[model samples]
Target chain A: MNDEKTYALKSKRIKWFENPLISEDKVYWKPKRAIWFWLAVLSFAAAFGVNVFIAPLQETQILPYRIFLASAVFLLLSLHAAALRNPFLRAKLYHYCQFIFALGIFLSVWDLLTDKTSVLPVPYFPSAASVLQVMVLDHALILKSALYSLRLFFAGFLTGIVLGVSSGILIGWARQWDYWLSPIIKVSGIIPPVVWIPLALSILPGSFSTGVFLIFAASWFPVASMTANGISSTPKKYFEAAQTFGAQKKYLLFKVAVPHAMPNIFMGILTAAAFSFTTLIVSEMIGAKAGLGFYINWAKAWGAYSKMYAAIVIIALEFSVILLIIGIFRRRVLRWQKGIVK
Target chain B: MTEVLIDIKNVNRIYRDDAGHKIYALRNVNLQILRGEIISFIGPSGCGKTTLLRLLAGLDKPQSGSLSIEGKIIDKPHFERGFIFQQPALFPWNTVEENISAPLKARKIYAENKHKAARYISMMGLAGFEKSYPHELSGGMAQRAAIARALLSEPKVLLLDEPLGALDAFKRSELQNNLIEIWQKTKTTMALVTHDVDEAVYLSSRIAVMTSRPGKISKIINVELGQNRDRNDDGFIALRKEILKELRLASISPQPEYNI
Candidate 1:
């Protein structure tokens, strides 16, 4: 036989483990079994150890902290086991762990109600009950503040996007524009929006406008910079190709430059959203009488720690939702870019 | 059939580096390409085959002398010329149909001749993938789409700069055959720059052999094969041998003076 034919025959005859052609599913638990099993064992051991250590610390003799610790351990173990050959077994294990954590929370809550004495029940631990009390008791105030903050955030972010992308395109395409605009933008970008709070206070008519201005300032630079970078790096091949196609100036910008620079534009939007949120909060704290940031600050001054924490939590939740929506938008727009890893 | 389409007269390109050293990309290059002729440029790497093709396409200007297309002095790229590069260069956001329609749409001919614009989609063998994006395609398929986009412009002349150089061997040959068939049917004036000697000889009516480093046209050999030339024929082998000998000789020659 020829050398290539012999080599092929030898390869085919080799064990499945030795064969690079063999699928990952075929090997199953043979390779990752030991690691999975050890992870399961160590995680469960850690959970049980934590439970034993934390059983005596609480005055009411509740083991809630221990239960949560154990819950984490079992969750980790279940995930590890799920990654193994049998997913059914992994699901069953995770379900059982969830049940154990629920039981732990239940037992601890019961202990607190029966063993402790206070007018406002379960006042200390800042559990789900306290979070619920803060929201339900001050429902009208909290709702109003949240709405106001959201409005400010959206206003600033939208304004930032429009200003940033337009200016970025201008700067990106024209060298003279870039040279002229870059330093002014740089100097302004470094001056914090919070520092602008006093300036906004002096000139702005309303506190809400001040907050919006702060958000716009914070968000604008990143969007502009990212968009500029995107346009500048617009592939020379596409530019030349479009030109050869007799694409006029407008068509070239809209068809070639815009789409090629979209990922960076999306990145700019994301960065802008993040900056807007952070800046909005700072502006509200320093200048505005309304918004989640002001609400938290107000609650803290009155030593309403639970209300302060609740307001903080609401802000976090709002940010998460906005980020999720943006993520969905990004995925939909850039669907073609899926399966490509940097 | 022998009507001249592009006349490149004594073209010279000289660039000065940041350190003030002169780099000559092309020098005293004169060539006339006939309408509906499939011409190939073949040379070692860094030869000015691509630069010459670009000049012909009106994408670049020669420092001295002039290029005329259809007896008009070419200052800028016109609707009559189209360029395809090794990269597919398809817009990621646009579908295959949209990419193909871009040239037509850009020229404001899309509204009146929508069906005509869409015809190139099938012509390029991307019929079913009209709505498909560039990133969704394999490398070969994307390059095919690029070819479709270029052909959609209905340019009199198509300039291809190693368009099939990125594909694997099988795909490369497949595209090569398809491109030749397309050229034969469409009869568009073409100037293809490629490093592969066999490819240049296979596709072109005339192969312009070029020298390496500050490239000069060494020779322009006329290929005498029939329209449907057999690759394994005695003539093909003999021509390949002659061209190979010329290339071998071209490689060993000392640097020619860059006369502006």
Candidate 2:
């Protein structure tokens, strides 16, 4: 009846080429409550049942109703929100419902083998229940270690990024700086930071500083190289265009070179973050008194395999959260890259 | 009597190819651009039309001779000479307003010329797209923004290297009119390099036809179609035919040795 409605109908008609049979809207309708959410709830309920009803063949640590209560609360909340399309986590829950179901299935199978039956060997492969219990029981030490690791990682990673980017930009822009500095960087970059443990520990005054040193080394090389590459690889056209408008060296560097090299710099930071984490764990394992890596080593020495597994899980979660933050920050900064990147 | 805006004399630009062979990008090129005139260098590819444009913009240096504007030697690029490339070359990060106003900021004269950016944006019909990024614009729109950017600087001469080559026919005609309007308003010297004979005829006061392989100007034709050129007019069609013939002549090389 209206112009917009006619245009919409015409556009929809154009979609006939994509699928001749199902170009109509009614064919693509989805239900109010997703089937996957209920399936996840059912799967989690089954795991809860296995944990409660069946007794273990051999004695293993099982926190009375922690898992049961948590699952019950989670299921109740999920069930309550299933029908509604409220803004908070509705889409996320629906999307990851299948993954949640698979996790429950995995936990159920793991429990049956290790705790409920004596088929698998003990200590080496602890039941999921024991691992979860260790996380709760050793919460104090775990929390302290996680805090220490965070401080060290942040100190090392931030320092490395700042220095790496500054020097990289210098080297990329000025030929003299590249000639003078890149050789040393290239040499240091070739050697892995893990190998510098003995040397760095000897040179640095303390273990914490040495840990910082190694992590800084791990992050520096990739950031520098990627930043330099990004800066240097900026098309000559950009420079020429800017120069015609009376842009001097400083303006050109800040405006044209820096903006163009941003995607590459972000690439470098991502790589550096990953590498720094690797070095963080290694440095902690070797000498540090408190960290996730240290916790892992400490648990292994005491034959507390469950604590070691718990520490590893915490490390993954911590690292993932840090990466998620970086990802969000980068997406906001590079919002202009939407159509260009694609 | 119009004064000479740019005096280009016997300029040569030589570039070395991969095997260390000397290649002539341009050779012995001479042209004098007059003030407030639209002049075009029209030829086939590799005729060094772009190379000549770059030389005028001071983006590239000549191996011999020199280029100067108003008796001042053009050694480096300056705001006095604005250049437009085939690609818009708008910064991907900056919005339309930012792109157009970037020159003012770059020159550290933003306070004085800040108002001109808004005027130019409206002039180019990019008023609503001030916040939109260059990637968000169509090819023609981006190029228009680029034109506005160059014009905001108020250059003495505007060198265009196939600025409308990438646009579709409709967009090209639309932009051609936009260019004509801008030219009429500013009266800036426009030196365009294009292969499109119709575009050359429709826009420029004079067309310099060039030959390839060590490029040189073969002929310069005065349009004489007067103002508001109708492409279908008898005189306009005849002039277009005359220029096309010159271009054909420029493309063919005379080799007496091959004559039977």
Candidate 3:
């Protein structure tokens, strides 16, 4: 097993530059000389080269040349950092470089289309510089909207999680509860939360509560259903064993069943998070005054395409950061399942 | 004779098979387990050894009879009867120490008896592995942890259902010795269900050979070879062969069938 692990590790080593003349055992694959690293560096360089030498077709054009240059340099310095000696960091860097290469190519293409040739429709496909400029100019507005969205999103998301998981456990544990609540959940959970918008708007006093309700409804079903499934699927032997040890009902529910169902609960949370985000945007678009969704809609209505695109970029980053945080929480809680799972 | 710690009177456990036929897991099972004595139930796969063990643990109820421990009718599980499952059913989320302390904590006595966790950990030879989770431990180590957990509650009778069945021969023998040592130290009445005839001969004062399909105790043999018993001794080997023959005969006996 040790030999096999070494063989697998060796096979994965980055072999970019090596002396073929050297003995087989002596030749080690080093990340510093990796072909992907060099290719990524060259792509950044090419993007800068194109931006600096070729002037924009439009006189008013402002390219984000400095940002691109800075990013490239940071990537180069990070690739050489001592931290890359750690296998996990090295693997991340390898993947990050590939992403950077793709991004560089995408930016170069966009720059060519928008600033140089003007082949694509103007204003709709804004230059990256214009989007960045709008981001800087409207920083306060964007920040306020982001904070607003976050407030509404989290308020709904947390409530959904708490109620969903608790009720799920109860329903799964008790057969009588399952008989009554299962049908309600099955019927109501199927209808998309957005469909309740009309009813929610009329019933709730304000748009904020309605928006929170929509997000809550959207997030609740996945968590509740998955958590129930997880709890119900826990092996019967565990319950029996716990019973034999004189464990009471409370201990059986929380200590035994809940811990066993953690992996599945986390999976439910992931799905719920995705749903909440989608619902958050839609809810804000319909009735909210100050949020990312509202800002994007407001920008589009006013024909400020660059600002709209900038808001969209912010939303994407926000969503990914939320997901990353959840992933970290899962790793911590389900630490025992680490090697067994992934 | 020692006092009867457990009395099983006309105990009959019924179950429904996959084909929707009512089968007798245990039929007219009457036995008295003496206090501070080790008893082994040996039989084939479908025999009611495990069913009997479960009844002793009060995890299951008999259909038409009663099981009593020390004059009290046993209907539900209690801390006084520690049960060790075939699989170390250690809670995967908890460490070895936590698993051992679970029953104590459940009974709301852990605060006073917390040190017993450490004592049992070392007793099971899992000194350094107190914080290790179930998955981290090897199969034998996990089973030992399970045994320690069961023992921590300090039950009067320890019921084992093929506890060492999953272990390799080397680990099984080592654990068998550990079991004996624990039994001597604690003097807890033990009722172990297993299929290994040699294990029965080595561990028990009496071996109850059971038959399947309307499972019944066909024979009960008294092992007169005293405490300092040797597996290699002619006496031990002879008893082991005798029990093995009884188990073989029990297996080949005509099985009663229930018509659907």
Candidate 4:
């Protein structure tokens, strides 16, 4: 009995930090040693070594300093990982270390190709160090263009989502409204909003307004279409039940229909967000004097390939961050669907 | 004669099927519900039992006829006439307590009657699950929550459309007792639709047998058994058998055609 009790207690012990390969019950993928620790150490060594041993073809401000700072940061992060008791954190740190090591190798190769060999042509493919240097020098210009793009993108996206959702609710709830509006939406929604750029530039007072209009037109149709489908497909029984509770037309439309269509509305908004970015870029490329798209164009005209690459990198990072924020919001709002979905 | 709480006169509801053929969901159906009485409409599928209930709830209008509560025409839904659908129909976004308080909130009387929401939650035996959402609750619990929601408004008449049909036998019997307890305490008039003959005989004071294909009521049987009725008792079984026989007959008999 004592032996059985001991076995039961041992089995019941909580293993908060799960090591998949080391666990007694089952074995899966896990390394014998801390993979992240070694990767982090190797990355720090490589970056510091490259900065000290290799000479750049073109000197740039802050290149060596940035590499030193990055190596120190990685060393500190690896030390922090070593002290963590949680396996999940350790696993995540390991993946991040692997990414950094891969990035360091790629950068080293690119630096060698541009500086020491003629494998990559000059004037077109600048060294990574030069790109970083250009980014540091043109920080103010990049910030200004990013701000301009954000302003136009947000203004148009907000207007489009608000109008799309409202009109969708109206169309979904009332038959007469659907009859009059659906046809108009179908015809107008199909034409790409950017196609009207020439006409818009001619009619609008400035490029700013034209850019905002293009984004709004690009984002509005998907949001409206998805919202309408969501509302129309809401179970009729819910409406009937609400009606029997003496709900008015407004109450049924707003309370019963809108909440039911939230998931679909969120999906529409996500689609609209993606579309708005594409439209914003195209609109900026057409005539905008200040924006990321315009900055790229300006850099290309001046044959400043390093600045162009830096701007492209900034845009990619900003777009990914926006998408991540939207994804988090979607998860929070639709928490009820967690267990129901896979 | 007890005071007539709901009066239905010569009601008919017609619909066009998917093939564009005219179908009579209800044909000249008429029934009177007394104040503080339990009435059950029992029939096969597509027999207008639900149609008549919807008309009483004022969810749909009947052509060439009318229904009234307290001598007032019911052209639209009123809080006095509550409805519980076949499915729980609880809002997926709302917790159990919130769903129960919906009717009061809808009528804009939630502030004054807020305390009553807790009482109804306990009354339905859903005390600990007030915070649970509809998807988390079992079918029986969700149905109970729906009942609490409908009753919180203090409706004079509660119309139930197969509210417990989806529950298992054990849960169905448990909810039947809950229903009896509720009716006894509140003395609220109830109209239930069910395919179960035993359920009809167990809870209702009178059972209305309906025929399909231009649905119409064939007979009304008054259950003489009093309160605290035992399901195992000989008289209860007899009433169940009689109602089942009547339903079987109602389904087999030829329906009369109406000239267009």
Report the number of the highest-DockQ candidate.
2
Q: Give the range of the ten consecutive residues with the poorest summed lDDT in model 3 chain B.
A: B251-260
Task: Write model 4 residue lDDT over A1-342, tens digit each, in one string.
Answer: 557434443553644334332343222234324666576566656765665587766555646446654766666575556646544455455546666667667766776687545368888998777787887889999989988988988888888999889888878878898999899879878898889899999999999999988998888888888899889999988888777776777777778888889899999999999989999988998889999999999999999998999889888988888889888998987776777765
* Over 4 Å off, model 1: A1-127, B17-19, B256-260
Model 4 CA lDDT for position B172: 96
Tally clashing residue pairs in candidate 2: 0
- Top-TM-score structure, candidate number: 3
Superposed Cα deviation of residue B121, candidate 1 (Å): 2.3
What's the CA RMSD for each of the models? 7.9, 4.7, 4.1, 4.1
Instruction: List, residue by residue over A1-342, the lDDT tens digit for candidate 3.
Output: 567435544665633222232112232333433567667777777766766777888543354555756677676867658534444345445546666677777877887788777888987988876787788878999999998999999999999999889888988889988999899889878899999988998999988899889988887888988899989999988888888778999988888899988999999899999999999999899888889999999999999999999999999988898899999999999987855776
lDDT of 1 by residue, A119-228 (tens): 23333334433454577678799989999999999998889889999998988888999999988778988887678888888999988888888888988898898888
Q: Is candidate 1 or candidate 4 better by DockQ?
A: 4
Runs in model 3 deviating more than 4 A are A1-35, A59-65, A78-95, B16-22, B255-260
On lDDT, the leading prediction is 2
Instruction: Check candidate 2 and list the clashing pairs.
Output: none
Clashes by residue pair, model 1: none
Model 3 C-alpha lDDT per residue in residues B218-239, reported as the tens digit of each score: 8989988888678899999899
- Quote the lDDT for B68 in model 1: 92
> Residues B94-119, candidate 2, lDDT per residue (tens digit)?
89999999999999999987899999
Docking class of 4: medium
